[model samples]
Target chain A: MAIIEIEGLAKSYRVYQKKEGLRASIRGLFRRQYRTVEAVRGIDLTVEQGEFVAFLGPNGAGKTTTLKLLSGVITPTAGEARVLGHLPWKRENAYRRRFALVMGQKNQLWWDLPAAESFRLHQQIYRIEPSRFERSRDELTSLLGVRHLLSQPVRELSLGERMKMELIAALLHSPDVLFLDEPTIGLDVIAQYNIQSFLRHYQELRKITILLTSHYMKDVAALCRRVVIIAAGRIIYNGSLSGIINRYGGQKVVSLQFIDGRIPADLARFGEVILEEPPRAKIRVDRRVVPEVLSGILAGYSVEDVSVEDPPLEAVIAEIFSRNGEPPEHQVGQIPELLKEE
Target chain B: MSEHPSYLRVLLTFARNSLVRDMTFRGNFLIDAFSSMSWVFMNLGFYVLIFEYTPMLGAGTGWGKYEFFVFLATTLIINSLVQTFFMTNADEFGELIRTGSLDFALLKPIDTQFLVSLNRIEWSSLGNFAVGLLLLAYALGKIDYSPGPAQLVLYPVYVLCGVAILYSLMIALAATSVWLGRNQTLYDFWFYITNFSRYPMEIYRGPFGTPLRRVFTFLIPVLIVVNVPARMLVRPLDPRAPEDFLLPIFAILATIGSLAASRWVFGRALLSYRSASS
Candidate 1:
């Protein structure tokens, strides 16, 4: 079920240009020209019920802006957004009751108060009946392993613990759709994995829809199979995360190991000498060419071991981001073993 | 599951947590409390010295020592309380709008104002209230004034109304943050208005004093809060009550209007908002 629908969604922000010197500051006070920045360009998207979609982008790439528009924190300058058939920006009480948004850079928790107090306040805000709130509160606290954190004030909690409590508070109302903007940011590897696992389980149990925007590829890799990549405020790619990998940069890395140093020419004939360490060398090949390259490398040299891998998502994303629309294949020769993997 | 705190319990917990958090700055709290006490004594020293010059200004509407000090102490107490509780996020509210930090409060399904206002409780300011009451009692003892029942009954109402009027005016002034992008100087504006409000308007040029008196009485209700009650304590009740006794009704209406306007401006600002993405 496609519970969330967005069509031709666009948002623009007004920014005043300032001159470099003190003169401009003085002049701006009297006379100023403002420009409209298209934060989220025309975007059309549909999210199915229970779908965990990663909305990925760089800074100012409109990822957070899109979430804000979707969550009703800010209104879009143009287009329409309906969450479960309710206009988000209109902020109808019913619509607000149905969705939750959590931003990593900002906290919703009362900084000085214990998480438990915040939870009870949330219950009153949502007008939750006591029994249901208790059940949900207990379920989230135990699941997040934050039961012990209930009595301690939020300011005393560690960053990981606070982020956990943030999630619990956001979910206390059991919102049907969750919009998370970089929720795993600044968490350690273990915390990230735990949160990701918990989200997956929580989503499955409640069948809630989730749309998350994160700069962390691991967050996307672990949680979202489908991704929507927005850059410069436009949706450049949308499909499976692997599809974006393939579309942007689909070559694979082939690393070769030997007992010691190796000649460049010996391995050069099979594939590009992308990396050269003491006894190890790396070559990249298209997935289509992996078999032939592997065989040729095996036939030509005394190879210790070989491994093929797709490039890190960050590297691939950086390449795509810096290109301003240039295809990744042109840079593949320079970006060693960088498989725009699907 | 059954052990979740009740709603009242939650608010108390929130206030307690704020107290605990402020306790970490215990040194600062002591310094602040001492600073407040010192300020009151200094102001009282002048009030005492005024007796050396003469008994009273004796001009019409000129308050004697008791009425004057009581009014001054009452306004200071109300001002400190508002600054402590209601204006906790006076500085942060602008940043909240600028950075979209307010979005979290909006999402909470709670009254955004209540959450933002109570988010930080300045526990040290309770000292100011204690000292304020002590001064009021001292003045009352000197004047041989005793408020039988009704006059005392209206004291809380006046003080609370004063705080509400002050809160609304601050909100209206802070609304400029939505457009100006900053309001660091707004507290000075609020403080100045309160300064003008504390002393009765009778000691002014007619041109200035009339408008000031009208503004405090009808529009903002600053005069009605402490001055009216303090006057009621010193002066006998008339068969016909002064027009200022009804000032709270007007202030309540204006507060509602100003709060609505602030919310409207906030809504408009949200459209132009670009969260600190740069």
Candidate 2:
């Protein structure tokens, strides 16, 4: 069953465009210029139950706006979306009680009070039964390894610890659907790994539907199997993580280690030499001709080891975003010509 | 299925959390309490000095020294309750909008207005409330006229109505922050508007004052907040004056209308909320 269904969902904002300089500022007082920003153009998407999907996009590509629309924080300008069988923008209490939204940049916990106090307040607001609330709170705190920090004031906790507490607060109600926007942003590598590990474990345990938007490729690579890439307010790709690499990443990188530990000056003849050293070298070759290139290299050089692998996912994703100008909408199950050199 | 939490339970939780937050900053809390009490005492002394020369607040106003003190006490009670429960929240509404923290408030499974209005209680402002009660008792004893049981029962009820009126106005003004981006002048505007309610309606009469009284009583309806309640307690309604009988009815209507209007404004503002980019 699909837990979220969005069709032609769009949101636009009218922003006042203030000109630079004193004279423009004075003119703005009388006649201000405004422009319509189409933050989320008409787009369609669906997520199945218990799926961990990554909503990927560049800055201002409508990732956070779409999340806001789905969470009922902001209404859309056009189209419709249903999450958990409820119209998100209607903001019904029943719908709100069933889902939770966590923004990494925002703090929901009381700044001066302990996280326990905020959790207790959430229990009251969500009307969770005391026993159930206690069980959920204890389990979440233990799972996040922040039980010791529960009594300390939120402001006193480290950023990573505070984020863990925020997650616990969000999950205490046992929401069926969770929307996460940049949850791993600005965290250290270890902190990111901790959060990613916890999310993966918890999702596996509960089988709850989650739509996470994150800039960290490591987070996407670790937790989400499915990915949706949006640019210019339109989704240009949506499929498996490997599928994105396979479709847009048409070249494979071949690394070779020479037994002689001597560099071949003419190695560039085979393909683009990405890296060259005395003992090792790497070359980028078209995927279809990788075998030919590898055979040619082996025939000339004293190669001890050779490996062929797809380009890094991060590189492929960056290429896609760089070419996302006026992106052609991508429909599910239909491959489109994307990332072609203009 | 989980039951919906009682609103009272949520309010109590907010109050508890607020108290803990205030206790975290003990020095600031103590200073705020002291300053609030000092302001109230200063205002009381100023009024006492004025009453030494004139027996009544205004000519033919029927508000003598003790009656006017009751009016002052009523103002303090209503204003203190508003400040304690809502002043800080209303002031912070613009900040929440600017910082996008209001998103959390809207996400909760409770009424947004209730959460925004009662999330913080300024324990310091309760000092004025205590002082108001003491002043009311002392003033009533000094006056020769005694209030009946009906008058006593209506006083507190009307006081609540007064608080509701002011809260509605404040919230409505705060909601405009959604469009304005920042409403820094909300406190100043509230002070200028509520300043009128601090005085007796009897004083707003004659050539220059009559128009102002009509405007405040009928249009803004702030005059009825303190005037109706104070009059019902200290000054009995005149049997011959039809306007006196109509004042209580108008007070109830004003409370309901202000609340409904503010609720509508808040709802509309929520729709316009851009929810600053995260």
Query: Best candidate, lDDT-wise?
Result: 2
- Candidate RMSDs in order: 4.5, 2.6
What lDDT would candidate 1 get against the real structure?
A: 0.74
Q: Give the alpha carbon lDDT tens digit for every residue of A1-342 in model 1.
A: 788888999988788988889988999989998998888878889989899999877788888888888877777888988899988876666777778998888887777667887787677667778899999999999998989889888899988899999999889888999999899889998889889989988988998999998878888888888898787887767789776667655677788887556655667666666777758777766667889998877777777887988766787777767655333345444433343333
Residue pairs whose backbone atoms clash in candidate 1 = A249-A340, A250-A340, A251-A339, A260-A279
Q: Report residue A88 deviation for candidate 1 (angstroms).
A: 2.3
Interface DockQ of candidate 1: 0.26
Question: Chain A TM-score of model 1 versus the true structure?
Answer: 0.92
Residue ranges of candidate 2 with Cα displaced over 4 Å? A328-342, B236-240
Share of real interface contacts recovered by each model? Answer: 0.31, 0.74
Candidate 2 chain B weakest lDDT stretch, 10 residues: B236-245
Number of the top DockQ candidate: 2
For candidate 2, what is the DockQ?
0.76
Classified by CAPRI criteria, candidate 1 counts as acceptable
